[model samples]
Target: MNTSSDDASSTSESVSDNDSDNVPVIKKSKASTSAGLLSEHNKDNNEEESINSMHRNHPPSVTLEDMITDICFHPKLDTIGIASITGDVFMYKYNNEETNLVSTMELHLKACRDIEFSEDGQKLFSTGKDLCIAITDVETEKLVRLYEKVHEQPIYTMTIINEHVFVTGDDDGVVKLWDLRQKGSEPIFSIKEVEDYISAMITNTDAKYLACTSGDCLTTINIPERKLHLQSEDHGDELTCLGLFKMESKLLTASNKGKMYVYNWGEFGLHSDEFPNATKKAINCMIPVTENVVITGGEDGIIRAISLFPYRHLGIVGQHNFSVETLDINNDGTLIASSSHDNDINFWNVQYFESLNVTEPQKGGKRKWLEHNLPSSKIHNRSDFFAEL
Candidate 1:
């Protein structure tokens, strides 16, 4: 991925030339393996040509201001919602062509850290620095109910698998599973005192398994039995983000120390067949575009496309001025919405392809320590870091 630093304004200026057909084309960089797990794959002629074509057609960027802590897209609507460090939430309606923001809504008090829409997209749920999770009517913009004191620390992430079931993670290293029907601030099932603060949570399309990533480990929980199925030590550092592709069998994780891991579920157990590719900086967010393709954002301000099944580098897009805090892919997988600590939301077009390639690991590396320390409230609340929306 590109590591050069540029101001958000400079990036935005490049984006403003969207209609120019002369923009330089990007190429898929050759991937380098870190551990012995990853293998090289040959790209077929048609597939290789498509991958090259995609790199040439760079997507235009759209910018919105605010230190976006979390972002999510409505399952069906051409709209994306964002939560900010200022304790506010906003929804942006995309243009008719679905490329730009047409409208917006400010929804919350302290920084809003997480946001999720109901299965039907009529209701919205948000949790944040204030330690409260609120359910709101999306159409009327009115708060329907508030789950107060649901977590001791600020809630960092949330996932709504279905109408009745949802999961939340906080800085306290707790993952709480809730039943919306309960109407109270109590969780039906809770996993207390995990190894590290839970930064990301996800459930498969079948809802058979739920996965939560904390630090460098990934815990997979069987939905029906609420039992821990697998705990994989895959990342080199704290696992800061996760994405489930197609189903429970395939998943991806991004870590604070710049590593990304891909795993597949097998009858025998969870197998770590591929991984150890490093990012330029701490990876804070991931969004799966297909069963094999995912988009990742990190502290270095670059977004990358990763191919899972065969394992390869697709391309990287850089525009954000600060660390990218969150990202969400539309249900159709045609657009991606991302936010950063510099307080900007950017939109990008999607690309699809087959086979891509990478290199195996080179020997002789130094031993390294891996740990993730949660930043204090002051770090997250710094005005210099969080630009106003």
Candidate 2:
């Protein structure tokens, strides 16, 4: 494996000049294995060829300013929204080779931290460092409403709870629940438990619980009960990202310390022995490709695939020129998109992703972790596991 310092060298290689033409074969070099990841000599010749083939198959990236903070795909359309630190939101129609700007809106006065589309993809919601939340009509490209000073500090994280409700977390470690119908400056509900910045928040499949993470602890709140469920002790690392697995029965949090902690849902005090030293570098973002499989982007600028049940490294999927700031998958799971603290957002093709999501894991096969007290009823559908909504 190459060291992380060499990851950006891979991006120096030019993409194919012809957008319509097939990607030319990549000559093996330090650039081929960005960040000194897997070397061609380490895998079977055919497997190495396949990995290179996939790398060559990726679409050209969308370039933007370093101010770009977040990107989200429209639920039902071929549209993408780019939010930037400069407080501008740009909409683009993305084809395989090119991204055409559809519209641009300057709504926030400061950095736009995060953005999400409503369930129908008709309305877009965004939060900003300006302490405001803005809703835009996707079809008309008009600002529907703006909630100013919604939080005391800069809002950094957000999650769509459901059609009628959404959630936001700010730098002050405050979490607020908002109702779309209310459209008020004040939130419908608010909670302040963690003393540091809110790094990430996630709602379960049923929206029965919401999990919030900071530099050290993970806090769970019961939605219906509107009360604290559990607060885990500090993991001694900044929890940068979180994901759920095993039918949402397990919670995994990745830290800046290059470790991933796995906990049984609702039991937050200890980590399961299933995952240890999940990655060598600090992970910034993660998305589940399947119930038992996930892809993570780290401080090293390399993106890797990992298996959950037995905690094995699948392999590296791709790399970025800088640390990956965020990750998103389309509704069909055919494409995985990642954004960095730079001007580029890269797209990768997930071959057979649909088929893989639908098929059940083979029993008594190579994955011994699936055989441990695994119950038949515990199986969850692909959408439920990813919790895209």
Best by TM-score: 2
Candidate 1 to truth, TM: 0.72
lDDT of 1 by residue, 1-389 (tens): 11111112223322332322222223333556633223223333444456434433423344545445667888888777766556666666774233455445455566677788898999999886778888898888888888887888877778887889888888777888888788668988887647577777777667877777776677877777766777775445777777666466766777767767666643213446546646447877777777767777778766766566556555554446566766777767666767665545566656333233323332223121011101100011222223322
> What is the C-alpha local distance difference test score of each model?
0.62, 0.70
- Residue pairs whose backbone atoms clash in candidate 1: 66-343, 67-343, 85-111, 87-110, 87-111, 215-238, 215-239
Model 2 worst lDDT run, 10 consecutive residues: 1-10
Global CA lDDT computed for model 1: 0.62
Query: For every model shown, what is its TM-score relative to the native structure?
Result: 0.72, 0.77
lDDT of 2 by residue, 107-213 (tens): 78977888999989999998888899999998897999889887888888889999888888888888888887884577778888889888888877789889988
